[model samples]
Target: MTRRTLHAIRHVGFEDLGSFETPLRTAGYQIEYIDAAERDLGQLEPLAADLLVILGGPIGVYDHDSYPLVADELQLLRARLAADRPTLGICLGAQLMAAALGARVYPGPAKEIGWSTLDLAPSAKSQPLAALRDVAVLHWHGDTFDLPQGCTLLASTPLCRHQAFARGPNLLGLQFHPEVRGDRFEHWLLGHASELATSGLNPVTLRHDAKRYARTLEQAGTVMLNDWLAKLKH
Candidate 1:
């Protein structure tokens, strides 16, 4: 059988696949990355691959001025969602999906930049995220998006309402870092150092927090990605 393709739209280098890398390959996917920040997305076909994963980034989906490619990404998302194709969005990517679907993506009341547990909605308990029950996912974004019309709200935290959403069986969106790899937790610390320092948070504190949560998050993230991909296979 030919290997399935998992094409990822990456905004930043450090925020690449993470735990999703191994799970995807093990599921017979050959990963290809598209750097959204470096290239023009005008000629890109969003649903050209078997699975399209829009990875998280530090920038906002609404930051079209700074990242003009976001406009192209939105156009791509519109096509993907219209086809009910398999697409996964993380953090800023999730916000982009919402915006593409005509939902409001804006700054939240407060920054939620730490490990936090989600309040699982009853309908969400039976989906791909079933493996992440009681899991404290890494939350690192200050922006949130309204649930797109006709989309199912899957999970939420105290600071954000639309932490996760799913539309039909093909599309899933996560606002948390369930795809982060624990062994490479150092990359996250170094990659986002300025944000931590600006927030008056210490790197030492993040190291300790990583020790407590990163391992478990990695394991759960693997299971969750596999589960979601399995759903796509069916």
Candidate 2:
């Protein structure tokens, strides 16, 4: 059997695949990790894989000067979006997608962190996000983006207006971390220690909430990602 390639553009190490990796491997995708933040991205080509997934990170998409790879990544995303290639974005990745599509990406009213539920928009209820209805996934970012033109608003929170967006069957962007797992959440706590302290969030409370809600995401996230991958197959 031939395996499809899944190129994951990773920003930081700890915020890796989490729950999403196993499913992709089981579904017969050969995963490739590219550390775009630290490595050079100038030579990266467009539509390089069957599936392209952009993972979350601490830096903003606007910080292209500090992180020059951001520009190259956005250029790649623009080409992918224009071609309608299969792509998925989580958190920072989602914000990058928005920026690549000519939308404004900026800081929101507050840093939204912890396990929180998104209020699904009416039109968003018909698709795979239906699996996340009432599901409180991990929320770990402060930056937000405007809804890109011609994109469907999938989910929202009180802190962030544009939590998830979908453009056709090929592109999906999510602000929250549905791919986060309870078992590995400690990595996030350790990884973003300064961000947590500055944001005035309690690690104990986040741990408690992760214990309570991460299981919900475990089931719902699987359903959501599987449904999405299935769509790509068709």
lDDT of 1 by residue, 1-234 (tens): 459888799988999998888878888889999998677787887668888999998888878898788899999999988888899999988998899889999999988888767898988878878788888788999899989999999999887988999988788989988988777888989999999989887878777888898888889888888778777742
TM-score quality measure for candidate 1: 0.96
- Give each model a TM-score: 0.96, 0.97
- Residue 45 in candidate 1, Cα distance off native in Å: 1.5
Question: Considering every candidate listed, which one attains the maximal TM-score?
Answer: 2
Candidate 2, residue 216: the lDDT equals: 86
Q: Please list the residue runs of candidate 1 whose C-alpha ends up more than 4 Å from where it truly belongs after superposition.
A: none
Model 2: worst 10 consecutive residues (lDDT sum): 37-46
Report the C-alpha displacement of residue 26, candidate 1, in angstroms.
Answer: 0.7
- Write candidate 2's Cα lDDT for 1-234 as tens digits: 469998899999988888899998988899999897666776777777999999999999989999788899899999988999899999999999999999999999989998888999997877789999988889988899999999999899988889999998889999999999899989989999898898888999999999999988988998899988888842
